[model samples]
Target: MSNITTAPFTYESLSQLTMKEGVLELQVGPAHAGSGHMRILVWVEGDTVVKVDPDIGFVHRGVEKLSEDRLYVKAIPIVERPNLVDTVNANLGYIIALEKLLGLEAPPRAQYIRVITAEISRIISHLYGIAIYGIFMGSSTVFMWALADREPFIDIMEELTGARLTYSHIIPGGVRWDLPKDFGERLEVALKYLEGRVSDYEKIWMNNPVVRARAEGVGILSGAKATELGVVGPNLRASGVKCDVRKCAPYSVYSDFDFDVPTFKEGDSYARLLIRVEEIKQSISILRQALKNIPEGKIIYEDYYKRMTPLMKSIYDEKGRVKFTSLLTSLSPPKGQSFSRVEGGRGEIFFYLISDGTKNPYRFRVVTPSFRNLPYFTHVMPGHKLADVPVIYGSIDYFPPEADRR
Candidate 1:
C-alpha cells in the first residue's frame, strides 16, 4: 500500500476548494431580517448548514459600564434601553437589587402593579418573538395576526405608563403609577380578544402542516445540553428543564399569583414556539388575577412617600404619579452588594449591584437571558439545513443588544 498523507485543514486550503461542491459561506447581515443588528456566517454543504457561527456585538452599548457613571435611580432607564421589548422585567430586576441595597420592599399594591406590568411586558416580548418566528417560517398571516394582537397590549401599556416601550415605571421604592381607573376594563377587553386570537393562531400557524414540517424536531437542544450550556428562558424550559426564576425564586408578587410555568419536553423550534403561546395564556391569567386581587393602597412605600415634597405628594395622591427628585439623582445606599433576578419573557435575568454608600454604584452587572442563551445557537445550528437558520434564530429569540451589553 502506498503511504498517503492527509492534507492539513487551514483557511488557505478551505479557500482553494470550489464553492459548488465544497462548503460555501453566506453572511446574513448587519441588517439581518430580524430584530437586532447581528451577522450570522453560515457554512453550507449541499443545502445543509454544516456549521453556523453567530457574529454578534454590533449593538453593544456598554450598559453595565454606563450604570456605574449614573446615579442608582437614573440607571433604570439606561438599563431599559438594551431590551426595549422586555422593559418592565429588565427594570424590575435592577430596581429589586437597588431596593435590597436600601432594605426597601414595595407595598402590596406596588408589588401587584409590578407583577401586572412585568407580565404584560412578557406578553409583549413573546408576541414580538412569535411574530418574527412566524415570518421566518414563511407565514405572513401569523406575523400579521401576532402584530395586530400586540397593538392592544401596547396601547394598554401606554395608558398605564405614559410610554409604550421604555417605561421605567418600577423604582426601588415602588411603581411610578397606580393602575388607571379604566385600566381593568380595557385589559379585560384586550384579554378577551387575545383569548380568541390564540385559538386562531393554533389553527392558522401552530397546527399548520407546513409549519409543523419546518419547525418540529428542528434545532433540538436537550435538557442535559441546555443545562451544560447554561441556557435560560423558554429555551431551557422547552428542553425539559423546569427552571423559571418566577417559580424557583418568587419575587415581586409572582408568588401570590396562580399561574403555571409552561415547559416542553421536545426542546425543538416548534416546542419553543408553542411555549410562548402557553406563556401568553398564563400571563393573561396572571393579569386577570392581579387586577382582581390588587389592593387599594399607596403605590410607593411610606419611607419614600414621606420624603416627597408636598406638591409631589399631592400629584401622587391625585394622579397616582410621582417625579424624580434631586434626592433620587443622588442616592446613597448603605455600603453593600446585592443581586436580584426576575423571570423575563425570554428567561431569567439577573442584576448585581455593588454600593459603596455613594450616589453611583461602585459596580453594576447584568446577566440577561439572551446572553445566557446565546450558546444554544452554535450548539444546535450544526445539523440543520440552511433554510432552518431563521427558524432556529427566531425560536431562540436572541436579542443582540441585550446580549452584547457590557
Candidate 2:
C-alpha cells in the first residue's frame, strides 16, 4: 500500500477547494463529504470533475447479511424489502438464481404467472419513477395522478397473491398460489384500464414542455457510455439502442410474449423518461395477452401443487395464496455460484448466489439500479444551476439507498 496525503474536508464542503489550483471540491452526502444526509463532493479542476468520492452509509440495512442466517426460502421476502418499487423483479431474479443453482425450473403455467406479475411490477415501478420525476419538476398533479393510477395494479397483485407490495409469491420451483376466482377477468379489466391510463401519463408528463425542458438534452449519455457504465433496461435503450433483457435474453415465459422494446436516441433525461412511459404501455399489452391466453394446466408444477393437502389447497383456491411444498424450508443449493440479471424499474438488477448445499446460502450479492446509476449525478450536476439538482435527480429517477453486498 502507498501512503499519500490528502486535504482536510468538511460535511458541506462544496466550496472552492483550491482557487489557485482551480480544484473545486464537491461534497457528496454518501458519495463525498461526511455521511450526514448522503452528499457528494464534486471537485472540478477547471471544466471537468476530478473526483466523485461517495459518503454513504446513511441508511445501511444488513439485507445480505440477514439472508446468510436465514434459510434460502426466508431470504426471498427479506432481500426484496430495500427496493420496494420493483419487488417482483428482485424476487424473480433471486428465485431464478436459486432455481438454477438447484437444477429446478418452474412449470409452463408457473412461468406464465411469473411473466404476468413481472409485467405488472414493471408498470408499478415506472409509475413510481414518473411520479418521483413529476414531484422533482414541481408538478405534483402528475405525481398525485400517477400514484392514484398505480393503486389498481397494486390491488390486483393483492387479490391474486393476498398481499399488495411485499409479494413473497415467487418461490423456488413455482409461484405460491393459483389465481383467485375470476382472476383472468380482473387482469383483463386492469390491463384495459392501464392501457388508457398510460396515454394520459404521456399527455401529462412525458412530452409536456416544462418536463421536456428539464429533461431534454440533459445528462446526455451516449450509447457507448451507457454500455460502459453497465446501465440496462430503458436507461440503456434511451440512448438509441434496442436492448431489453426481456426480448434480447428472454427469461421465464417472456419469449412467448409479443411486445416491443421502446428505444430512443436522444440519450438524455427526457429520453429516459419518455422511453419508460412507452415501456409502460408495452407492459399493459403483455398483461392483457397473458390473461387472455392463461391455460388450465396445474397452476403449479404437478410435482409440487399435486402434493398440497386439502387445507392448503383451500387456502390457495380461495385467496390465491400458494401453499409451498415442504422442500423450501431448507433450500440447500449445490456448492456453486450463480448470477442472474433482470430488467428492474430503475435499470438492470443483478443477483449473485453461492450455496454450499446447506439450509442457508454461503454468500449472496446484489447490484441495484440506483447504485449503478449514481454516476449520472456527477456528470449532469455541474452544468446546471444548483436548484436543478433535484429536478435532474428526479428526472433520472434516483431511488432509495439499497444494500451493497460487500
Candidate 3:
C-alpha cells in the first residue's frame, strides 16, 4: 500500500482557500428561543450543509461547582435552577442520589405524590418544548395554543409547591407537601382539556401538509445510530429505541404506574415531535392512575419528622407540609458515592454524587438530556439543507442552560 497523508481542515486553511466552487460559510443563531444565545457554524456546498459545528456554553453558570459549595438540602434550589420547566424531574435525580447515600427512601404516599408532581412537570416541559418547536417551524398558532394550555398546569404547580417554577419541591426524604383536597378534580379537568387540545394540535400542526412535508423524513436518525450516539428521551424513542428510565430502571414509584413509552420508526424531526405528544398523553394516564390509587400517610421520613420542633410539627400536621430550617445545613451523610437517573422532558437526566461526611459534598456531577443529545446534531445535520438545521435542533429541544451546567 502507498503512504497517504491528509491535512487538518483548520479555520486558517479555509480562510486561505478561494471562495469559488460554491463553498459558503454561514452562522445560525444565537437562537432566540429554547436555548438562548447559542450559535451554530454551517458550511454549505450549494444549499446542502456540508458540515455543521454547534457552538454552545452561552449561559454557563457553574451549577455543579455551586452545588459543592452549598449544603445538601439547600442544593435542591441550585440543582433545579438550570431547568425550571422540569424542576421536579431535575431535582429528583439529585434527591435520589442523596437518599441512596443516606440509606432512606420516601414513604409510599410520598412516592406516589412524587410521581404525580414529576409527571405534571413532564407535561409542562413537553408543552413548553413543543410550543418552541412550533415557533421555530414558523407556526405561530401552535405556539399560541401550546403556551396557553401550559398555564393551567403552572397554576396547579403553584398551588402544590408555592412556586410557579424552580419549585425545589422534591427533597431527599420525600416531596415537600401532601396533595390538596381539590387537586384531583382540578387535574382531571386540566387533563381532559389537554386531551381535547392535543387532537387540535394534531390537526393544526402535525397533519398540516406544510409541517408534515417539512418535518417528516427530515433529519433521519436510524435506530442503530441513535443507540450508538447515546441519544436519550423522546429523541431516542423517536428512533424506535425501547429504553426509558421510568420503564427500564423504575425509580421512585414509576413501577407502580402503567404507561407506555412512545416510539416511532421514522426517526425524523416529525417522529421526535410526535413522541413528545404521545408522552404527554401517557403522563396524563399516569396522573389519573396515581390520583386514583394514592395512599394517605406521612409525607416525610420518620427520622426527619422526629427532628422537627413541636411547633414545626404542629404546622406540618395542620398544613400537610414540612418547613425545613437551616439546621439541615449541617447534615453530613456517610462517606459514599451514589448515582441516579430520571426521565426529563427532553430525555434522561443523571446525577452522580460523592459525600465525604462533611457539610458539603466532595463532588457533584450531572449529565442532562440536552447535553447527551447534543452530539446527535453533529452526527445528523450534515447532508441536509441549511433550512433543516433549526427544525432538527428545535425538535430535539436542546436547553443550553441544562447542557452547560457542568
Candidate 4:
C-alpha cells in the first residue's frame, strides 16, 4: 500500500509538485463521467494517485448574491434550484433562518407537513446517490432499480407540492400547501412498496460479493480524520461520528419524530454506501410517525393566515393551498442577523441571513453539505489507485451543483 498523508492540500502545495519526476497530471472534468459538474485535477505516480485538487465553480449560480436582489418569498425557488433532489431540506433551512429574523414560526400542522416532505425528499436524494454510485461501480441493474423506485416518491411530492423536482413549496412563514386529501393513502402504498424493494436491494447490491470486493476496504476515512475534515451526513456518520444536525439541533418539529441516526465504524467506501441505506429506513420511520400523528391546524402561521383575502381564503378552504398575499412579497424583517441549520440528505445545510428592514435582504449566505464535503477529494484520494477516484467521489455522494452554488 502507498503511504497516505493526512495533511491538508492547497493550491500552493499542489503547484509546488507540478513537475516532480515519475508523476503524471490528469484533469477529470467539468464535463463529468459521474463526478457531476466540477473538475478534478489528479496527480498520479505509477497507478496510485498522489494528490487531488477539485476545481469547482462550474455550476455557480451565485444563489446568495441573487437572494439579496429578490424578495424573501421569491428566494425559495432560487435556493431550491441548487439541489433539486433534496429541495425541501434546503428550503426548510432557509425558511427557518428567515423566520427567526421575521419573528414567526410555522403552525404545528405546517411543521409536521414540513417534516414529512423533508423525509420524502431525503429518500429521493439517497436513492439518486445510490443510483449514481451503482453506475460508478458498473452495476447497471442497481442503477436502474434505484432510479425506477424514485418515481413513486417523486409522484408523491408532485401530488403534495404540484412540482416534481424543484417544489419551492416552502415559504418564509410556512409551507405553500397543506397535505392533499389522498396524500396519506398514496404515501402508505409508496412506503410499503419501497420497504420490499429495500430488501431486494440488500440481496442484489449490498450483499453482492463483487460489490463488497470493490468497496469494502477502499477509501477509508478514520473517525478522527473525518471530524477534523468536518465531514457531514452519512459520510461523517459512516466514520462513527455521532453527529447529525437534526439530533444535535432539532428544528421544525423534528424533535417530535422517532428515528435513529445510523452509523458504521468501518469508514470505508462500503460503510458509506451502507449508511445511506440505513438512513433511508430511518427516514421512512419518521415519515410514518409524521403522517399518523400530525395534528390538524392551519398550514401557515396565524399572522399570515389572517392576512388571506376573502377570495384567497375561499380558494384555500376549497383546495388546501395557501395563496400568498402581496404583503409577503414586500416582507422586511427587523435589522438583525440569524442563522439556522438542518440535516439535509447530504448533510447539514446552514443558512445565515441579515435583514436591514428593507423589502430585500441585506445579505444571504448558505453553506451546503456538498460544499463542506468537498475537501474529501483532496484528503481521501491521495493513497488510492487512479480507478478508485470515482469510487471515493461516489461514496461521498458529492453533488457538484450544490457545491458550486457560491
Candidate 5:
C-alpha cells in the first residue's frame, strides 16, 4: 500500500508515480461534472481508493492580493466574487473587518437588514450545494428542484440590492438598501413556499433508500478526526461538533435572534448532506425573526448619514439605497489590524485586515470555509471506494473558486 501524507502533491511528483505496481492513478477533472474548476487526483487499488489529492487553483483570482490594491469600499464586489452563491456573507465579513478598523457600527435597522439578507444568502448557498450534490448522486429531479427553488429568494435579493448573485449590498457602515415596503409580504410568501418544498425534498431526496445506502456509512469523518483536521461549516457540525460562528461568536445582529446550530453525530456523507437541510430550516426561522423585530432607523451609521450631501440624502429618500459621497473614496482607517469572522452558508468566513492610515489596506487575508475544509480530500477519502468520490465531494460542498482564491 502506498503512503499518503497531508502535504499537497506537486504535478511532477504525481506524474512520476505511474511506475508503482498494483495502484492505478486517475485525474477526476478540472472539466469533470462532479469536479468544478478543480481536479482530484485519485489512486486506487482495485475499487478501493487508497489515496486522494485535490488539485485546486484552476479558477484562482488572487482575491486577497487584489483587495490590497483597491480602495476599502471598492473591494466589496471583489471579495464577493469567490463565492457567488453566498456573496452577502463574503461581503459582510470584509465589511465587518473594515468597520472594526474604522471604529464604526451600523444602525439597528441596518444590522437587522444585514441579518435578513445574510440568512437569505445562506439559503441560496445551501440550495446550490444540495442541487450539485443531487446531480452528483444522479438524481436530476432534486437538482432541478433545488435550483428552481433558489429563484424566489434571488428575486427578493434583486428587489433589495439591484442585483441577483453578486450583490455588493453590505458595506462598511451598513447595507446598500433598506427593505422595500412590500418586502415583508414577499418574504413571508417565499418562506412559506420554501417550507413546503423542504418537505418534498425530505421525501424524494433525503429519505431515498438508494441515497441512504450509498452515503450513510461512506466517507465517515469522525468528530475527533474532523476537529483535528480543522473542518468547518456543515461538515464539522455533521461530525457532532457544536461549533458555529453565529452561535459561538455572534456578529451583526445574530445575538438578537434565536436560532439553533444543527449537529449530527453520524459524520458520514449522509449526515453532511442532512446538516445543510437543517441549516436551511434554521435560516428560515432567523429571517422571520429579523423581519418581525426590525427597528425603523437610518440604515447607515449616523456619522456617515450626517455626512451625506443634500442630493445624496434625497436620492436615498426616494430610491431607498445609499448614494455614496466622495468622502468614501478617500476613506482611510487608523494604522492597526483587525480580524472578523462571520458564519457564512458554508461555515466561518474569516477576514484579517491591516490598515496603514491609507484608503487601501496595507494587507488583506481571507480564510474561506472551502479552503479550511480542503484537508478532507486527503484525510477522509483513503478507505472509500473510487465510485464514492463524488458522493463524499458533494457532501463536503467544496467550492473551488473560493478554495483556490488564495
Candidate 6:
C-alpha cells in the first residue's frame, strides 16, 4: 500500500506499473460538485489489491426521514421508489411487518393475489437486473432483449392495478382487488412467453463464453463468508445456502406452493446470475401452482371495510384504492416490535416494525437486499482489472449508491 492522502490516483499512470508487490486499488468519486458526477481511481503497486473503495451519496434523497413524516399507510408507494424494480417484494415485506404488529390476516385468495404479484415482480426485477448486467458487460443486444421482454410483466401489473411501477396494491389487512376474469389464462400465456425468453437469455448471455468469462470466478463468495457478511437472496443461495424465507418461515400462502431454492457451492458471479435465472423459472411454477390452488373469496379483508367510517368506504368505492382499509388508517395494536423477512429480487428484505397501541407506528426499520449485498463490490471488486469492475458490479446487481452509503 502506498502512503498517500485523499488526493487522486490516476489509473492512466498506475496501469504502467508492473510488479509482484501489492495490487491496484480502485475507488470512485464525484466529477463535479452537486453534479452527481462519478470518478474512478486506481493504484497498481503490483499483482495484489491492497485497497478498494466505493464512495456514494451524491444522489442521497433522505428516504428514511421522508418515510418518517408520512402517515402509516402513506409510506407504501413512497418507499418503493428506491428499489422500484422489486416493488412487490417491498410491499410484501411492509405489509407482513404491519400484519405482525396489527394482528391482521389477509384472506387466502388475497394471499394468492400477493403471491401472483410478487412472482410477476420477481420476473420483471430479474429482467431488469440481467439487462443491466448485460449493458455493464457491453452487450447491447442482450440488454435490449431482456428489457423488451420485461414489458409483458409490466403489462400484467398495469391491468391488475392500473399502475405500471407503483402498485400500492397490498395493504395492512389484504390486497386491493381480486384477480380479473381470465387472469389465469392470461398469466399462463405470459408464463409460457417468459419460459421461452428465459431459454434465449441463457443462450445469448448465461451460456455465452464472454459473459461466462466475465462472471465465473469473478466475485467468488464462499458459503461461510456469505453467511458472515449477511448476504441474502440469489447471492447467498449461490453459496449453497438453502435458507429461503418461504421455505423456512412459510409466510402468506408460500406453504401451499411447491418450488425449490436453487443453490451452488461455487458462489461466483456466474453462479449468482444462474441462481436468479432459475429463481425466475421457479417463481413461474409457483404462480402456476397458486393459480391452481386459488380459492374464491373477497380480495380485501372482509371486515376491514365494516370497521371503516362511512366516508372512508365511499372514498374506497370511488377511488378503487385500498389505502382506506381500516387496518391501515387507524391501526392500533399491542406494544411490540416484529421482524419479517421476504425473498426480494435482489435479496431478502427484512423489516423491523414497532407498534405502540396507536394509529402511528412507533418505529420502522428496513434492511433492503442491495444494502446487504454491497459487500461484494467493496471487498470483491479489487484483485480484478479495471475493465472487469462493471462486470462484477452488475453481477452483484446493486443499485449503486442506494445499496450502501447508509
TM-score per candidate, chains pooled: 0.94, 0.86, 0.94, 0.97, 0.96, 0.86
Which of the predicted structures, 1 or 5, would earn the higher lDDT when compared with the native?
5
* Candidate 3 lDDT trough over 10 residues, lowest sum: 1-10
User: Which residue segments of model 1 deviate by more than 4 Å?
Assistant: 1-21, 34-36
Which candidate number maximizes TM-score? 4
Tell me the whole-model lDDT of each prediction, alpha carbons only: 0.86, 0.74, 0.86, 0.89, 0.89, 0.75
TM-score of 1: 0.94
lDDT per residue as tens, model 5, 111-154: 99989999999999999999999999888999999999999999
The Cα error of candidate 5 at residue 11, in Å, is 14
Report the lDDT tens digits of candidate 4 across residue range 1-406: 2244444555566666777888899889877685678889989999988889899999998999999999888898899989888999999999999999999998899899889999999999999999989998888888899999999999999988778889888887778888888899999999999999999999999999988888888888899988998988899999999999888889988888778989999898999999999999999899999889999988888888788899998988887788878978888899999999999999999899999999888999999999999878988888788888998898999998999887
The residue-level lDDT of candidate 6 at 179 comes to 75
TM-score of 6: 0.86
How many clashes in each candidate? 1, 22, 0, 0, 0, 2
All-Cα superposition RMSD per candidate: 4.9, 6.1, 4.4, 1.6, 3.0, 5.8
Q: TM-score for model 3?
A: 0.94
**Candidate 5: global Cα-lDDT?**
0.89
Cα lDDT of model 2 by residue, 116-148, tens digit: 898899899989888877776778898898899
> Whose lDDT is higher: candidate 3's or candidate 6's?
3
In model 6, which range of ten residues has the least summed lDDT? 1-10
Model 6 C-alpha lDDT per residue in residues 221-249, reported as the tens digit of each score: 77887898888888889888888888988
Rate residue 56 of model 6 by lDDT: 52
Residue 266, candidate 5: how far off, in angstroms? 0.7
